[model samples]
Target: MIKKLTILATIYSLFSLSGNQTLYAQDKLEVDVGGALRFNYNLSSWKEGQKNRGGDFGYDMFRVNFNSSYKEIYLNAEYRLYSEAFGGGFLKQGWVGYHFNEQDEIQVGLNQVPFGIQQYNSHNWFFNLTYYFGLEDDHDMGVKYLHVDDRFEYNLAFYKNSEELTFGGDSESSPNRYSYDVVGRNKEVNQFNGKLIYKFGDSIKSRLGVSAQYGGLYNLDTKETGSHNGLALHYEMNVQNWNIKLQGMIINHDPKNLPGESDEILQMGAYGVPYEVASDFSVYTAAVSKSIPVKLGPISNLEFYNDFGYMDKKVDRFEDSFMNVTGVLVSAGKVYTYIDYAAGYNHSWLGGNFVDDFSVGNPDAKWEARFNINIGYYF
Candidate 1:
């Protein structure tokens, strides 16, 4: 099935490429390809009192993007490849669009669901700085419609997704059960999402967005059926050198399980004092990140940055799971290099229980500290 999907994507890409040639005389075609190399060192990998230290080095990503615009028509395609160790491989995105006028357009194809800012800026390393607050949603093959004006923009999308898993670990073996967020069986799922954004001239930029998805899970053997639903709210603001964003999500089940469990989540973050020290230098950029569990306590974190062109100075607390209170002060002239350090009390929280299982181990809570160094490039 994956191979067939890849072939279909290739065929679609060729079709779009050929269409670009005759779409419009004023149309333009563009292509982008880039990759990132990173080496990370873990100070503490052993649980609690054990000492298991190791590091990873590899190409984090390799991706190609194609975009074309012809008069009132537009098309885009992207393909990405990465190491299998990171659960990475190849995925494709293809979409075709038409502009009714300067401010209104509609697109239909395998496209992105406009649920979060980070989801739109996947190619960036920093991930727009807002993504760290946990608003990143997955992409889907679906139909989408978008409307954009001077100050207001809106997006609506519907998509379907399917997967097959055998709990016994053999590919040919049929699993005893099947489930999905929207449908009870390992069948196609119907998803719907919508977003609205309002920009307030130079003073403040704000957006209010909401999304709800519902469907059923079909059991293959017993033919049992289960239902699932997810709802979320997102808001963000940018004032001067300060930026703040908040998001909340409620799920009635695993969203992937036929008879999944229910869970709720809330996350928020803020950054301030983005000052420029020189023509290509900046200082005093600080941020705070927090997450509140539905029934557990809150996790507080902080991050600091001083970037100067190719060089950056960073210090923060537990950027993600398996990392804690890490700090890095590096100077990259042409080659990227940095001396990193960190210390924290715990690496994670929640004791790895039902909540972790429901959310797929997202928003991991851990406490620890470490130090390391590496060199890399971005082009």
Candidate 2:
């Protein structure tokens, strides 16, 4: 069993440009520890052998999270363990934060980047297509600042690089990471991010935001650095128990490769694998879901959703890519289960060799589908 503790600490006042926040001499430190265990079962249309064997079911991951706070200072971290085939084990995120006041705060260390629809843009376990391009739910070693108000939110961050102390590989850019990033002959560096969000509405609350990223791409062979830029617009709405999301983004990576290397396609890697991706592209995604109260004994609620994304490469000869997922989430006490059916065309994770699908995709390749179920229990 995990232990929870609250201890008295010497309080310190946080001074800011505006004023000083007074803290009592005696403040209590609050700590909470929790985690989850997950499992997965999947059947893929592209895997004939897997279908013949009636699919596969196995352990997915085990993770632990720690959070503590005292006065205006706080810290949180998460570590995860997965099967060796999925990159073994690594720290997801660990950061220390401080509150200048109720509206302003700062975080330092490994933290999620401020971008797009926030922690996630899709409801399914697979996430949205933007995740593969390093635009959604991406985390890096950096510093972050946040400002919040009644109707607006602002985030600014500077990331020196991705988490380099990952599980596998001895190279400068390791593939055993939780998020996709520039790997192989190039790496991401000196990245800056900005996001602004506005909230409004009476009966139907809505939020609209824009995110921007600018970074340098360092080519190992040439020892020269190039640049990358990305811009995105995201919107979400909640009307009663119904939810909707829409997003669009454009990304460009210009790597200064060696004389013989082509810059048309850049390499991105994660989860102990590398794949090719188009250098210049635009992505659009839409997702919707509705929650319904359930009375199936232990079951409490059900959420049904559909998510879709499309990628349009700027290169004339490159083929397009798309993914669609329909799923349902069942919540019962501490256990949550997701049943999903996903289909993709020219997508990397979905099918078709799983290598150059995001680059010059196989135009002759047919769409592939996968049936998946993921269940997790929280403590």
Candidate 3:
């Protein structure tokens, strides 16, 4: 109840101030509401020798975004409804921000952690392996400072807690789940994230950036404490209608105390215990995309893309994993679609093989392929 009241108060204060300021200069006030409706059909190969066989239609996502601005003050929020069995309405993002100048801004509340490429460059709606490791398109509650100019961009942030977790019988993550950050541990305490990027060239510009994250990982079971740190180097370039990107990252999760001579590792993410450990792992990704002129019905543009990714874990009997995705995107006004074919091997933990279900007996060590299509409209 107290938390709810505080959130309400903050929202009320923001609106009150915005309304008062906008009244003085009503012409500067702006309000916009937008959202998307998505549908998906997937054909997945579960085992080593399987054909594309299941036919299911899902009302994947319905999102509503609201944005209001009055001079330097702004409010941005989005709510989403998913069609999954365990789905309902939730806040995807909400923030209040103040702009000091064209190049400087500060935002408070739940915002995206400025890590890795945002929104991702993937044909699949699920993104890639980096998401599972909390490296791509992840959000947290924090205060963020952003500075962007002609040559450089800077992002510095501090977060109170990590992503929210659900518990008990109705919990999104149940016993021994293998998706999302359901470990219930590894809460962020005074977490700090910083990123810097440099842009060069004119027609063929290169975007290069280095990012780092460091914070405490608290355990819910033992009330013990741990720490996790990550470093990444990312580079992207666009030439004509073609765009290319590459990223590499190293992450370490170190427990404050470990049993003597235990030789145990603290694993994170959907892998749960015994598989994911308090060790270091590396991920590398590369992707290329090109826009081509194509007209099919209302489709006026098409984009072809390929994404390659690999992850290596330093554990015995655990083979390295890789994913290769090739697909095309079709666009027509507010309508967009994706047709992708993805194949992978030995990425039981870090890839799409474990995406839908993370049960104990699920096939994780087998080769798999999937054909996915997503259609959506913005309104």
Q: Which ranges in model 1 have alpha carbons more than 4 Å from their true place?
A: 1-25, 28-54, 116-135, 162-188, 222-225, 254-378
Candidate 2 residue-wise lDDT, 1-379, digit = tens:
1556666565443211100122222268766667889999999999999999999999999988777777787776778888888788877777878888888999898888998997789999999899988888788999999998989999999999888874343356877888888898888889999999999998999999999999999887788999999999999999999999999999999999999888989988888788999999999999999999989999999999999999999999999999999999999999999999999999888986778999999889889999999999976
Candidate 1's residue-wise lDDT over 1-379, tens digit each?
A: 0011112212233333111121322233332333335554333333454243255444444544455554566666555554554335433455777777767666666555666443432211232222322224344557778787777778877775422233332222121111111122223346667777775546766766665665553434334444445565656565654445554445443223324322122111112101111111111112222222232122122223221111111212212222122233232332344444433221122123312211223344443334445455433
- What is the model-wide C-alpha lDDT for candidate 3? 0.65
Instruction: Give the root-mean-square deviation of each candidate in angstroms.
Output: 14.0, 4.7, 6.8
lDDT of 3 by residue, 81-186 (tens): 7644434556666778888888888888777788776547354555676765667766677899989899999899998865454633323222122223324333
Question: Pairing residues by index, what is the TM-score of model 2?
Answer: 0.93
Q: Given candidate 1, what's the lDDT at residue 378?
A: 33
Candidate 3 residue pairs in backbone clash: 265-277, 266-277, 266-278, 267-276, 267-277
Q: Alpha carbon lDDT of residue 45, candidate 1?
A: 39
Error of 2 at 306 (Å): 0.2
Q: Count the backbone clashes (under 3 Å) in each candidate.
A: 23, 0, 5
For model 1, how big is the CA root-mean-square deviation?
14.0
Name every residue pair that clashes in candidate 2: none
TM-scores of the candidates in the order shown: 0.56, 0.93, 0.81
Which candidate comes out best when scored by TM-score? 2
User: What's the CA error at residue 108 for candidate 2, in Å?
Assistant: 0.6
